[model samples]
Target: MDASEINAITDWLIDGARSAPMPSQMMAQACERMVAAGLPLWRVGVFIRTLHPEIFGRNFIWRQGAPEVEVGTVDFEIQETPEFKRSPLSLVFNRGLEVRGNPDNLADVERFPFLLDLRQEGATDYVAMPLRFLDDTVHAMTLTTKQPGGFSDAQVAALRALTKPLTRITEIITLRRTATTLLDTYVGNRAGERIMGGQIRRGHTDTMQAVIWLSDLRGFTALSDRLPAETVVEILNHYFDCQVASIRAHGGEVLKFMGDGLLAVFPIDEYIGDANHVCARVLEAARESRCSVDALAFPIGEAIERFRFGVALHVGNILYGNIGGGNRLDFTCIGPAVNLAARLEKIAGRMGRTVVASEGFVRACGADWNELGEFPIAGFSTAQRVYGLADEAPVVMA
Candidate 1:
């Protein structure tokens, strides 16, 4: 590779990096250009650390003649296994050193088993370089060739010359992916997009009618206190799985989790049926929640019955967006109906009901529910009416 070839690859990479929406696409183009420049690159792999709740990192692999990049994710357990310890990527990440191994050629050192496997597959050279970020943490950039002579000094120098631009391109891609992963992990997808679209102002809110869904374990405090700390966490996660799966399956976005409680919303947009579709979604979610929670019992016979929980659904206008103080904020709903939903859940057990809702929700759902009489609620100037969304017979209480 000469100076002209290197310059052309750098220019093409700089231009393509800006237009590519995905990191894999940018990498694919770069690999194709490198191979075109007479660099016998048979396979290329890059790994990046990201800010996702469940994902530790991801690997993007490009092979000759493949249309695009193939991706593999690194999870928590994968990071701890012995398989990662003996790999070139692990050495680069852990020791911040460059590694070159060629098992096919005589007199060349081959340390890891993976390199030997690559040799058997016709690879003549394997080189892994440490990709550093602004924070100084090392990721990975690797290359392999199947040519008989392997990579010449000129080819390696050309790759070394592209590091600055490579770092910039990958930095942009990783940061973009980090922003989306963090936002989607913390906030629901739609709400996260709204926030990302410049809705971070403290007073920024939209008044929209949505069905509010709030639910919590019936005896979470007692359950947590009576059980081991580890058991408590397991129980909480199990309980959340039951609610979250149901809500997401019904097109509801889980907005927040307050210890034992979960808050969600099914926003009703411009399109409206005779009865709002959001109501049925919330009802369907509630039914699924009730059934699933029933099955989330302790594996043992420690308790006479399964764990219990209650859900409250109400439809009304809400001020949804950023709200808080001291430079921190919460992107959540706030309105009279929000208060009413929580208060309804507070009395659900006393009323011998597992699921309850307001008249507005009942009307929108087009369900025959027993109406609960009006009652004075805290933080409210007047009494509020309610209705039952329970599967059982009516059991109204004060």
Candidate 2:
């Protein structure tokens, strides 16, 4: 290719890198270009194993090409420059050429059984390539063929040329998703605007007034004991889905699912509304939680008590940013206020109330609440005047 033509192709790739949401699609387009530019090829595939080993796990069909194989294949290692041994039945894992001249070895084919059937089916060639973008450790692309002879050396070179740009694009999309998920976990609300701010500085912090709600599934342990493992997971997922949807639908963020319960919050942004507004939003979430729970008719396989939820909402300043050590960090909030919310939620269970809030929350709401009385709550240094948010008259407990 001439310098001008190569420059045009490079520009097109750069533009694609900017627009594409994933590396796989971008690699497919690049491979199409390589094919158009005289590389004989029909299929293109990408594999990323950074977070999940299953991306290139054993018996993979994209590489091994055995139709009879159930699971795909994995590559523990790769050999360079040798003509790839193509098999009609072998599963290919690497990114390169699998051709007729590439002699197949029994021991190698045995290691990846997905390739066994491909050889039996009269398929002979494959090529898989590994692409690394930025600082990532497990991202690569693979190209394959069912024909007798695999792609030529020049074709492999063309495929290699597209690797860097493809990797770079993949890295960006992956990082962005990581950041967004972190923001959602900590902010406890839609943080599109807040996450946008994170792009400005690497480790800046912000304190926002937010209404935090913590709720746990009651009798979860006893319920789990009675049901089979599959039944347990199904029930938990169904319950969590219902609870989380109620929270998210009312502009609340489900921060973390703590096995049996969830933590959530509605950010009281000055630009959005006020504390009372945020509490009402949380209260709406509470009502929705009850409604959703009541609607569930899940069978526990025994005469188990119906599921119920306990919620506590508190509004205060929570310092939000990333925490933890090294690269393994979490973007979440911390402070006395978060602790208080959790404390009250626990109190709800002991006091036989579904929803409980501190006197401070009630004062912030500037509304009357059913008097549940001042009591010494565990983990709190002093007696806290708590209130019960019931559907009817307050039912006080000892």
Per-model TM-score, in order, reads 0.88, 0.56
What local lDDT does model 2 show for residue 306? Answer: 56
What is the C-alpha lDDT profile of model 1 across 99-146, one tens digit per residue?
888866454533577776787788888889988888898888999998
Evaluate all candidate structures by whole-model CA lDDT and list the values in order: 0.81, 0.62
Error of 2 at 30 (Å): 10
- lDDT for position 304 in model 2: 51
RMSD of every prediction: 3.2, 9.5
User: Residue 262 of model 1: what lDDT?
Assistant: 92
Model 1 TM-score (2 dp):
0.88
Query: Which candidate has the highest lDDT of all?
Result: 1
Global Cα lDDT for candidate 2: 0.62
Error of 2 at 163 (Å): 8.1
Off by over 4 Å in 1: 11-16, 105-110, 228-231, 272-275, 299-305, 372-385, 393-398
lDDT of 1 at 223: 74
